[model samples]
Target chain A: MAAIYSLYIINKSGGLIFYKDYGSKGRMDTNDSLRVASLWHSMHAISQQLSPTTGCSGIELLEADTFDLHCFQSLTGTKFFVVCEPGTQHMEALLKIIYELYTDYVLKNPFYEMEMPIRCELFDINLTQAIQKDRVALSGR
Target chain B: MQFFGGSEISPSPPTPTTAGNNAHMMYVFNRNGVCLLYREWNRPLHTLNPQQDHKLMFGLLFSLKSLTAKMDPTSAEKGNLGVPQLPGQGCSFHCFRTNTYKLSFMETPSGIKFILVTNPRTGDLRETLKYIYNLYVEYVAKNPLYTPGTPIRCELFNTALDQYVRSIA
Candidate 1:
């Protein structure tokens, strides 16, 4: 529910098209974020390749006490990551809504070319709505 | 008026054109009673009257022929955008039109060009564009079929544009 501090989208080739860190000094450096995106992209690809033939591929979840990382890989090799506080509830629904946004606003936008980072205004607006809704729900209002 | 995406406007007649370039033209059609086309860039358009509180829907629409024609000599004005159907034939174009002024489009090689038909006293490009951007976010976008360059026909978009137009009227 806390506004997403930042978001990174990694292409199949591991290039970063969109990156933003809001309201924090711990802003991820562009180079470092790119490197991390690329690394994660490779890791994500490798994980998919190593998956048992019958099931879905890639790293679906990675967690620590302070934070959690969620990766969603589309059929075309684009990966969407959501890093949030570890204990956030209803994470599945939240991620589903976020993925819907990625498809509708990001992928569908003519301005947003595939395998590139997101830059569409609609994408951010919908994302903010989804996150804000979750935050409000978490607050028990 | 600002140009964006795959639409083009034909050249206006020899008179002093609302669009700067002579090549700018409008693809006009009748719906209900008003003429419609994709709003072009960099042209003066009609403004809504304040007391009437109307909504104006405005944006860009593109065609593959226009896209290819400007880029490749072999493709100018030829239907080559690959869609089997005529994309712009009845598409609802949003323009703010008050009795005193009307907004319109001018076609160019780059994208759909905008032309304003406003009384000089009641218009400002920056403010109009800002209002458009807000409307786009609040209304056009909320609907699913409002794709860029695709003719919009949803009642919601019409209602919103009408509201804006009425407000200014």
Candidate 2:
């Protein structure tokens, strides 16, 4: 089975900037995705505040019975997260690669606005390619 | 012979205290979002008032449960997002980990929720949470004076809980 089910990217201010589903059985509408993204952002921040020690970076992984959610927050506070089947390996590496793709195709595009919904066609095409590559590598292994 | 005796009797190398102070805090909330118990062992920060803190924690759990249910891949019925779900109705999360801490959650069939915040490096705590539920059942649930849905104030329960948490932490 493909490891990743879906992906979401949230802007620094807790706005859902992008969302894509990679053949997940449970598909969410746009409004639902938006709500989920902002809710996750709040939960992440609250987790940081609820930390007993200093330097906590917020929630990075959530493990459910059937799936796992892995999140990576950039230095600029943008968050990238993937929901995948339970016990999927190499998710952190995949998220980092997605971040790189975002930087290259979306951020570098002169027409792309900062902290806004990602509408870059190049980004969409490259993200698909990257995800497909990962899927193929998994199947080969 | 003397060296061998010393080695054998040296308290087994102090048993390696590598698991130092793993638990940070815990919350026990009954159904209807009432926090029945709150305990802290190593928390160094308190940003919100106790009431507000409990409310936020409960809210987080509520939203997360619904979200997980709505996103269940194996289930055909997709419930409305953000709606409350009955216990055991959804694919509930066991825990979440951040850089600093891990939050392990459990909900009993009776709708009692248990949340344990621990060190991020702590391993899977599913069994530990089950043990904690057992503790609750023994101490508070069976106590004649204890009232359900109220803040837990039983001294025996608190003592037993502290001792158990310390042992595991």
Candidate 3:
């Protein structure tokens, strides 16, 4: 069964707020993942400028030979990056749930600062459970 | 928020009467979730309250869209069920399809939903829905008297919709 490689979230300032590698090997080191997040942030901006339509909604999907990368940017500018197996179903739902969790676990925390790294244990646990449940459901098992 | 013009929404539930089943029942909901225009032709049963039923229908579509997007193996373009009839789209299953009723739904970018319920044998109504949308845009949207996010009460729109629905019915 295809699996999620990693998930990264970058705040509006292009700082990596949340990162996780669901795979055992944890494909890339922390430095590489941070670079990847910042690079994607610039790429997303460049793509928007290159868009012919002024009302373009921005990049939604990135397809590669090995994996499918889905990016969902909320209205508030917090972007959720998900790298998963190709042909994953209900990706939009996943992004939405993640955003909701961020609002609840990260943003709602009084000690949490806006646009900072997500360090909430509740967020971590909920995200893991949500991803596992979604993976299981996707496998139709 | 502006369900019916700028005035405050009535505290009472929108119970605008019941629907008649005459092989054709069409509902036009504004973006504010108000049942602006509900035209029924040959409707027989009044078992369900009209306003309550409209709310329920809207809620059902909401859930159906989420479920369809969740089931879609390739979900792009704002959670559209590009490949429809997935396992989760059905709402009331098992006993839901005892008759020959077909429900076709189309949503415009502006968030207005057009629902047409007809015979199960009815052909694809996507194009027909588009045509109806055009009529709505021209007659209702363009009308200065017709406020946005409010029930559509334009005479021309109602007449045109009635004619179009009759021709297709």
Candidate 4:
């Protein structure tokens, strides 16, 4: 089964708060991650600026045949990213859990530097458990 | 300190009330060496304590959060309390401990009313909210020892709350 390679968090202002890549790391670097986060943030702001005024608040998600990109925003304007393989069901639930974890762990952590790499163990543990639960439900295990 | 459910532990003193009163009060029940507080909402909050006055409501809010674990448990605690539901909907579970005091707020769905859990004597909500939110932002949210989906009580959350409350009052 294809596994999640990493997770990243971007504040609304186009700053990176946390980023991490698992072993099978794609062609990504800290600089690339930061640039991507900034680009995404700018694009999101521009999209909202050009929106129909009432139809969309910001860029919700980007998807293709092979990969899926999910984003979530808090009332205070923080954003979270979840990249997953195509055809993953319950992506919304996964994002919700991740958002909750961020609020309770990363954002709540005293030592966490805003716009830095996400190194919190809780984030990893919860993500793993959440993925496992999904797999179990998916496989009826 | 024991951390449960992504919240910090507060060292603020308890606000005691007689079981006879209908107003909400914070309760802490001791078992073995651990203490558990019972948290709930009696009604909706009518207004946000003006941002300037939130410091006074901290301790009461923490006790409520500690008791309820931040879960809106009005329905779950209903049978236990033998109290009927509020007639419209459920109470929003919001409880947290700050560098100052523990604070809890319950706003009605309509946003017209609010219930502030506070020390029966001081009766402040603004202080509590500000302090608790600050704690979440500063200590609990920043601690590396904290894990998501698990309850919270890192030394940072506790020490910050204690120091804030003591310094203020």
Candidate 5:
């Protein structure tokens, strides 16, 4: 079944705080991934500037030929993005779920530092299990 | 406090007077964590002693770099996701932004770190920092009397930096 290729959560400062790759695979290096995250950050800022309205906004969806990218920004400016196949359904729901998981497991954890990359074992486990469940559900459909 | 709208700034320990000063402050640090040069204009931070503030800033950058390195998915042992990957030991990020202020950072290959504090509206300063690095090499490094790891005090370098910063501000 078609599924999410990967997920990336970038802090407001353009650092990759969290990342997870589901079954789908790729070989992008660390530096390349960092560059990609930063590029999205700059592009997000540029897009907001180029917008006709002068309100708080960001890139919610970016549809490409091979893959579909969905982005969600929290009120605090941190961004969460997911990469899935072009025809994937309800990816936004998955991004929302990730945000919720991040808030519950990462933010509430006393060990976590603000604005730093995420490094919580529970957060990682819960996120992986949740994604696995979603994949199973998608295949069962 | 966080909007990217036009920001009017005061020059040199942040003062009451409103003027243009994109390059509000500059700091230089060696690989050993020693501060080589610390310059500020209209500095808003007077409560924290200069020494304490510099130490805190350097600490912040060091910890942040370590954290970024650890979070990188492709750094090492990608096959195993359960272990803590904090020993990866490298990070590549340009700047970090807060609501009111933005801190731009540049690290030289030789391990010297240059940190610039500016308003959120300031443009990208990668080239500007490279130019400043050149100026440092020309004046400070070449001066026969100047010793390494000491505070930078080249009059020519200061004058050039002043003119350049004011132009951007």
Candidate 6:
């Protein structure tokens, strides 16, 4: 089964910084992806306000009949999320690895601007490798 | 455990317990996007006015429904985004969970949407939503004085809903 569908990274202010579709069945155009990202950002914020408790963060997981979206928001408010097949295991760990790759290859590069779209070739290579590794490991199991 | 040595990034917060007053609010929207009912049990913050809040919720559901349908992995016919989908026409989301709350949604074949916002740690609510739908059918839908597509004004329905929600929350 195709475990992962896509990955999205949104800036703190709800801008789409990075989006990649990982050979998923349904493909979204750039415009559609941007719209979805911002919509998710707004929904996340609204969830916080809708919460009746204090110190509530935004949405972490959205489970649909066909797909599941898992989100991880860093302390700095940058959001990393993955859309995967429903019941995909170890997504949280996968997201954490992706975040680490972002820090190493994207953030460490001097040319990478803050809050801008990630354009680092090294980051792309590393991310692809990490995801491929995950796929191989999962399939092996 | 300590993967990032000095970065501010940390693991997500621990999941909250399902105990206590988990139910925060609920919304009942008719087929035409009219809010048939809105109830609040434990909301602390109010960012938008009542009208705006209802609209936003409806809009979110609209976009999510289309997105999910468009992103259906098994289906080959990819429809245009933002197009309205009939209830149960495509793969739809059951619920979404944040750190604090979970939003459970169910749309009947008749197009009535039942949304329940509860604590994030709450378990599957498919059965609970169905039970609520049954309540609506009995008290609100069956009542002769209650008109369809109008805001729910039946006291019997409200009382029963409150009692049920209290039991779950």
Best by TM-score: 2
Worst 10 residues of 3 chain B by lDDT: B91-100
Q: Which stretches of candidate 1 lie over 4 Å from their true place?
A: A1-5, A22-25, A49-56, B1-169
Error of 4 at A26 (Å): 3.8
The positional error of residue A127 in candidate 3, measured at the CA in angstroms, is: 0.7
Give native contacts recovered, as a fraction, per prediction.
0.00, 0.69, 0.00, 0.00, 0.00, 0.60
- Expressed as tens digits, the lDDT of each residue in B17-71 for candidate 3 is 3232223577777655688778876444444578767876665555434422332
TM-score of each model, in listed order: 0.40, 0.90, 0.46, 0.41, 0.52, 0.88
lDDT of each: 0.44, 0.84, 0.63, 0.46, 0.66, 0.84
Q: Which pairs in model 2 have colliding backbones?
A: none
- The Cα error of candidate 6 at residue B15, in Å, is 12
- Model 4, range B33-145, lDDT digits (tens) per residue? 12222233232222233221222233222232222221121123322111223313323234322222233354322221122333323333555545545665577557777
Docking class of 3: incorrect
* TM-score ranking of the models: 2, 6, 5, 3, 4, 1
Question: What are the per-residue Cα lDDT tens digits for candidate 3 across A1-141?
Answer: 447767889999788988987762323557656766776676566434322122333446554324556778776778897877756767867887888888888999999999888899999999999999898897775
List residue ranges in candidate 6 displaced over 4 A: B1-20
Task: Name the runs in model 4 displaced over 4 angstroms.
Answer: A3-5, A22-25, A113-117, A139-141, B1-169
Model 1: per-residue Cα lDDT over B42-132, one tens digit each:
2232333321211122111232122212212111233332233233332212232222223333322223333334321233343444454
DockQ of 4: 0.01
Choose the strongest candidate by DockQ: 6
| Candidate 5 structure quality by residue, lDDT tens digits, B86-145 | 322353445654323446777787778888766555666777788888878888889888
Regions of model 2 farther than 4 Å from truth:
B1-19
Per-residue C-alpha lDDT of model 2 across residues A15-82, encoded as one tens digit per residue: 99999987777558899899889988988888777766767778889999889999988878999999
- 5 or 6: which has the higher DockQ? 6
Model 3, CA-based lDDT: 0.63
**Consecutive 10-residue window with the lowest summed lDDT within model 4 chain A:** A47-56
